[model samples]
Target: MKTADIQPFFATLKAANPSPQTELEYTSVFELLAAVLLSAQATDVGVNKATRKLFPVANTPQAILALGLESLEGYIKTIGLFRSKAKHLMETCRILVERHDGQVPDTREALEALPGVGRKTANVVLNVAFGQPTMAVDTHIFRVSNRTGLAPGKNPLEVEKQLMRRVPGDYAVDSHHWLILLGRYVCQARKPRCWECLVSSYCDYSPKTPPPQGSLR
Candidate 1:
């Protein structure tokens, strides 16, 4: 999309949902970090299902450390790569407790230093928990950025930089959530629901998908 269309594109998203939030269920910053960690190859629904059981039992770094690796694995065993994720969570908690006094650090450097926390995960925590304007370019954000011509790039890091530079300051902090939701629900990968997309008018994609037979446009 043209730079001129960027404003209204995000404006429409903001009007539709003024306050967007991550689908991952979390009551605390640490919970958010943990949920994002466990969500690498898993869906928010799956992560939430496991975290629902795990958080009540152990929500903090110290509390999670108390659960032991085996128990932690048991709690999240339903998720794919549970063993590795559990191991990473265990190590991350150890670092949080030993290095940061059991508190989730807000800095990108500190967050990325933890086990299992990559740039994407760090960006998510920094944006959602700390209200930073960092873009966590997940598959959803990456696809939406390219598909909508909002910030097309060959890779996630490239896309993230593009978004950081392109997105308006007023919508920067929450733009990640908007693009993610748009991709997840409307500008889908397999087949975009362009017929119902609210911002399709500003999108650059061609031959927008039509509504199914008997479906309302």
Candidate 2:
């Protein structure tokens, strides 16, 4: 997309959903961090399903550690890579309790130091929990950025850099959420629902797909 179209593109998204939020359900910063950690290759729905059950039982770092590794694994066993994710969560909880007094760290350096927390996970926590303008380039964001010519790049890090530099300041903090939602629901990977896309006019993709037969606009 052109530099000029960027403003209206995000403006439209904001108008449609003024306050976008992560699909992952969490009541606290630690819960958000844990949910993101468990969501590596899992869907938000799956993560939420597990967290809904787990958080009430063990929401805090100390509480999670008290649950023991086996119980933690049992709670999240439905998710993909549960064993490894549970181990990472256990290790991360230990670090949080021992080093940070059981509180979720705000700095990127501190957040990334946890065993399961990568740049992407750190970005999610920083953006959603701390209101930072960091972009967490997940599969949806990556696909939307490349497909719309908004911030095309070869990798997540490259795409993240592009978005940080290109997105307007007013929209930066929430742009990742908007893009993720757009990609998840409209600009889909297998076949984009261009016919119903609200911002398709500003998208760089050509030959937009038509509505399916008998489907109403």
State which candidate has the highest lDDT: 2
Model 1 residue 127 distance off true place after TM-score fit, in angstroms: 0.7
Cand. 2 TM to true fold: 0.99
- Give the CA lDDT, 0 to 100, for residue 188 in model 1: 93
lDDT by residue for model 2 (5-93), tens: 99999999999999999999999999999999999999999999999999999999999999999999999999999999999999999
Q: What is the lDDT of residue 72 in candidate 1?
A: 95
Check candidate 2 and list the clashing pairs.
Answer: none
lDDT string for model 1 (93-202, tens) is 99999999899999999999999999999999999999999999999999999988999999999999999999999999999999989998999999999999999999
What local distance difference test score does each model get?
0.95, 0.97
Clashes of 2: 0
> Which 10 successive residues of model 1 have the least lDDT summed?
208-217
Superposed Cα RMSD, model 1: 0.6
Error of 1 at 122 (Å): 0.4
Candidate 1: residue pairs that collide: none
